[model samples]
Structures are given as structure tokens and as C-alpha cells.
Target: MKTLVISSSPREDGNSHVLAQSAIDGTVRAGHDAEHVFLGDYVERMLGNCRHCRRSSDGLCSLDDRYETLLLEKMLPADGIVFAMPLYFYGMPARLKTVFDRLFCYTANSAPQQDQVINGIMNKKVGVVISCEESYLGATQGVIAQFQELTRYLNQDLVGVVVGNANSRGEIVNDPTDPVSAAANLGERLYTSRVTDYRLDTARSNKVWDCSPVGCPDR
Candidate 1:
């Protein structure tokens, strides 16, 4: 099985990244191949919120950006998806949100409300690893609420939601069975439920929108 772990922290060695990498290592230890993707690696190449929704008709994004490869190669085919996010203003980072926003393309061909279209994540399971500075109970759940809604909309199965408490690098190591280990376990646990069809329409790579209205780079 292939597990794709998405590290959303801007810093390469940030706590979130470390935990994500650890999860990947655990996934490998459990007899599976995994990929640890750093969002910072492609953030600059991404033009978030293109506002075109052209994929709805053309079966492809309107604007040409990094999202095509990111979605096609890593996201669509993966049996399991892990989102390692660092808390910002008690919520997910903007870059991760940008990635999530682009996912609207998955359901582009169907009506916004629901003319009946089953696409996107299908039966894939989603795992969330949250890193927060505050130890308050609501800190992590606050973000989980948003992700829960998104998973429901995408028709994804949210298998796990783990929270890591730390601000500095490597601090997550203190807890022997905390998020770090949980994340690693999640890598293999998702295999309990699998989707038979793992291919999606990812051939098109054209962006056909003029999204200067939101003005989020690449304008």
C-alpha cells in the first residue's frame, strides 16, 4: 500500500515535518512504501484560489500550476492520505487550505449542490496529524471540525485525528505513544479498508481561468 503524508509546515525541519517523516518511517517499518511531501516544496509554484472552476466543464484546471502534478502523481493514486498540519490562528495553514480549495475540482463536473456525482476521494481514508503550541482541549478539535466538514463533502473516510503538543523541533519525541507514534500507526491502519478502483482523471494539465479577483499570487 502507498501512504502519502503531506507536511504543511513552512519549515523543512519543523515539528510538523518531523512528525510526518516519522510517520512515513513507521509506515515503512510496517511493510509499506510511503512518501513525505513538504508543502513548502511546492507552495511557491501554487496559485491558490484560481476561481475559474473550469475543470467543471473541461475536465481540467483552467490555470496551469503545480496542483496538476501534485494531485495526479501523489494524491489520486495513494491508498491512504495523511495531512500533517501546523496550527495557525487556531486553524489550518493557508497553504493547506489552498490545496484543499483546489480539490473542488474533483467534483467540478457535477452540480455544486448535488445532481449526483460520486468522485473525489471515493473510499480513501484520510488521517490528520495536528501540531499545536497550546495544550487547550479545543485547540486541535477546532481545526478537526473544519477537516471533518471537508472530508464529509469529499466523501472521504476520516480514519484518525491525532494531536501533537510542542512548539520546538523534536519535542514530540518526549511522548512515547503520542501523535508521532499514532501518525506512524495511522500509516498502516488505513489499510483495513481499501478502495478497489484507485485511478482518476488526471491527464489534463491546463489552467483556463483568469482569477485575479482573489489576487493570491500568479495573478
Candidate 2:
């Protein structure tokens, strides 16, 4: 399967990014094609409310911007999309949230003249990878609810989430094996499942496919 991983952390090698890399690594190891897009590396401009002007026919953004051509193009036709971001003040990062905001062109806020693509948002599964400073990782419920609401708008499935405690660059690598193992299994589950029924709380606890009876990579 083709998977698109979006890293929303601004740090060059932050915890969020480390978890994202692990997920990408697991995806490739499972024989799937995975590509990562670092939001920090891109120039995603903040967009305003759809002007609803006759110029709406121009599916492109009114402002001459980079995302209009680059990241937007990649988002199209991907089977699955993963969002990796560090929790910022109990919520998503500002820039990443801006990317989500820009995607509103596909929805009700679209300008009347905006050249919005028909069925611009449909038929994709979404996942999340998060690394927080707290050891207990207490924000899964809120994050899952947020993703669920957003996915409803995009008509996408909220497949799963991977939350790991990470305070330093690459610290997650040395952290407990369960979350990382859970991440790898999540990649495999995405490949095998069809209807997307996993719950964030249970998935993290069940540790599906993390390790086999013999301790081999279950994936």
C-alpha cells in the first residue's frame, strides 16, 4: 500500500519526528511504500476564509503560495495518511493546524469561485503519531476525538494513533518498547484491515502484533 506520512514537528530531530521515522521504517520493513513530508521543511502559508468570489474557479489558492502546488498535490490519491506532531499546549502545532485549515477549500467554506476539486476529500484512512513530554501520555482521548471530528469532515477513517513519551531528540528510541512496537503493528494492521475499527485506547493497550510467541516481529 502507498502511505503518506506528514511530520508536523518543527524540531529537526524532535520526539514527534523520531516516532514518525519509526513508523516509516516499519512501513517499509513490512513491504509497503512510504514517503514522509516534514511540515517544517515546507512553506505552508496560513490561508484565510474562502473569498467565495467568482475567482473560486481557480482551484489554486488566491495567494501565490508554495503549498498550492507541492504538498497539496501529494495529498491527492494517497491510500493512507499519517499525521505526526508534538502536542503543543494540549493541541496540535500551529503550523500543522494551518495546513489543516488550508484544506478547508474542499469543504463548505470553499469560495463560490474557488476551483475546488470535485470529491476533493474522500476515501482515505488517517492515523496519528504523537510524542509528548509527559510520561503517562494522557492526551490520547482528546487527540482521538479531534482526529475523529476532522476525519468526519474529510470523509476519512481514523485508523489508529501511536503516543510515546519523548522529551529529547531520539529519546523515544530508548523508551519503552511497547509504543514503538505498537507503532509497527499499526502499520501492519493498516495493511490488513479494511473497515477501520480499532480504538485508540484499546489499540495501545492490546499491543497487537507487537511481538510473536517466539518474540519475532509480528508484522
Best by TM-score: 2
* lDDT tens digits by residue: candidate 2, 1-219: 888888888786788777677778777887888888877666456776555421545544565456555445666656788888888888888888877776665444444423443354466777788887776546656766788898876678877888887776877877775667767666656655544355666544445555567875423
Clashes of each: 4, 7
lDDT for position 77 in model 1: 78
lDDT of 1: 0.72
**Top model by lDDT, which number?**
1
Error of 1 at 26 (Å): 2.2
Q: lDDT per residue, candidate 1, 22-76, as tens digits?
A: 7787678878888888776655444434355446664445565566577767877
Model 1: colliding residue pairs: 62-207, 62-208, 63-207, 63-208
